[model samples]
Target: MSEKTGTFVVTHAESESAVVRDVETAQVHTLASNPGLEVHDVLEATVAPEPPLEVTWEVIDVGDRRSIELVDSDLEPTQHEKDLAADAEVGDLQQEERAGTGEIHVFCVPEDEVEAAATDVLEDEETVARAARLEAVRVEVRRAPDAGVLSVRYLPD
Candidate 1:
């Protein structure tokens, strides 16, 4: 079976199952439901054919998840945060490795430059060489706050 990637809009969700509509093909799919999913949530999944034209999907990620929204809201800059933000020069980058996953978190990138920064980080020869040794999975760029804070998550294979 081949794999198909697309965004699915959740139509109905229950404890064990969910009905979703694919944005690209307009096909409806049913799969095991995930907790906290609700109607209208957009999920990114890779679907593979099962049998008899039936398909099963494994969710790769969720867009606009509530936890992310909550985090964004919580990261709003207060007076102290604004002061700290002002002190740091824009375009500064910081990297830290997660304890167990070996995932790398690159922080403090300006929101306006995240896309370019992510591309540079992923395409750098040094980063490429290191990732080749680590067998990394993928790099994700995220905007953490409305005030232009960005972070990159580098996941390992």
Candidate 2:
């Protein structure tokens, strides 16, 4: 005995495209667009059926579930932050080890999302400094987590 799969028909909008027929029942199939209406015309007025809208997306392959990037935003680093960063001291062994392993990623999210963190970090600093440098980017705003923030990675070139 053979199992039979169900036959189906589907129609979307005033689609000039569709498939409607049963393979087992050989019958005449008709593709009739509204009387005398052209493809574009069927999709235009308040009378004809709606058309399927098309949307496009750009694909990206970021290395990891990684840090946020500030690409085209109006954000900029602050002068006070510059002074503070300049005054920042070197990290001890634990800090140095984190830098060496590439584990910590920093992000500067929108001002509204920064929680119990020091307001000075985001308010004074425009760019979210990361253990790794940003290579490729999407036009978006992302924030980093609460961790020992590093002003700069003093790792030698």
Candidate 3:
């Protein structure tokens, strides 16, 4: 069997994104915000840190798929930002709870990549990434106003 990727949420399977996980290479399919970028022959996941945005949290329940609360990463919002987000009928988002944010979030980023990165630190001492295959890996992502831990679940291809 070829490598495969399996996307997961709550207790459901997202078959379309599920494919075999290639140990040597991979293609990550993150959300529109975080495009699945490729790393060629990445012997290991190099620490490439990005600056964190000032965010507040809000959890929008997805019901079955999963309740996804979009956390507004912008905590210190400008006057314009606040005005735009405010709704007369709905409560002020900025003033609302952080767990009440985040909406229409795509299941971004492959999980295997995260695992490989965590494991790579130990695995690299023995083996080196000689080649990489452009395989899509099923991944689960969890986000919050406070950066939470995200994990990936690989499936057989």
Candidate 4:
């Protein structure tokens, strides 16, 4: 068997296997699960062209931790928002305003909880009403293992 090396973005993950998208070729590859792997983490893998294309991946780098951006807000996050964010396992909440565009950024979120957390934060009664009035509320969540460097962006619509 021959060896191939490439960078891949994990697209799907389960206990036994995962589907990864090759960064250079844009082709999908499957590999035995690396417990450390998470969706959206870019990694380098050594693959053997066996019958099923066996692969082993190592996380050489990590993506940015910032997740969830709230756009076009005039007011600061209320106590309710803070409480919700904290309960959702978010850390380092920062707000920024530039050219009438308001954005809220957060870090240190768990990959598995990104969608649920974002939904809970954005779907709150007050947040829902505010988002509806704005006509466009964008939230992005990036999750990773807190103990290691594996990172994945799980954005909820």
List TM-scores for all candidates, in order: 0.34, 0.18, 0.15, 0.34
Q: Could you tell which candidate, 1 or 4, scores higher by TM-score? A: 1
For candidate 2, the per-residue lDDT at 66 reads 24
Local error of candidate 4 at residue 55 (angstroms): 10
Q: Identify the superior model by TM-score, candidate 1 or candidate 3.
A: 1
Model 4, 1-157: lDDT tens digits are 4555665556677877777665566666666555456654555556544345345543323432111233333233344334434544444444333234433344435556544555565444333222222322343333333321111122233
Candidate 3 per-residue lDDT, tens place, 33-115, comes to 21122222221222121224312111111121112111222233333333434332221122221132221111122333433
Top of the candidates by TM-score: 1
Best by lDDT: 1
- Determine which window of 10 residues in candidate 1 has minimal summed lDDT: 65-74
Model 2 lDDT per residue over 65-98, tens place = 2222323223333333333434443232122223
User: Model 1: which residue pairs collide?
Assistant: none
User: TM-score of predicted model 3?
Assistant: 0.15
Q: Cα lDDT of model 4 overall? A: 0.43
The Cα local distance difference test for each model comes to: 0.51, 0.26, 0.23, 0.43
Error of 2 at 150 (Å): 11
Task: Give the distance in Å from residue 72's predicted Cα in candidate 1 to where it truly belongs.
Answer: 19
Q: lDDT, candidate 4, residue 68? A: 27
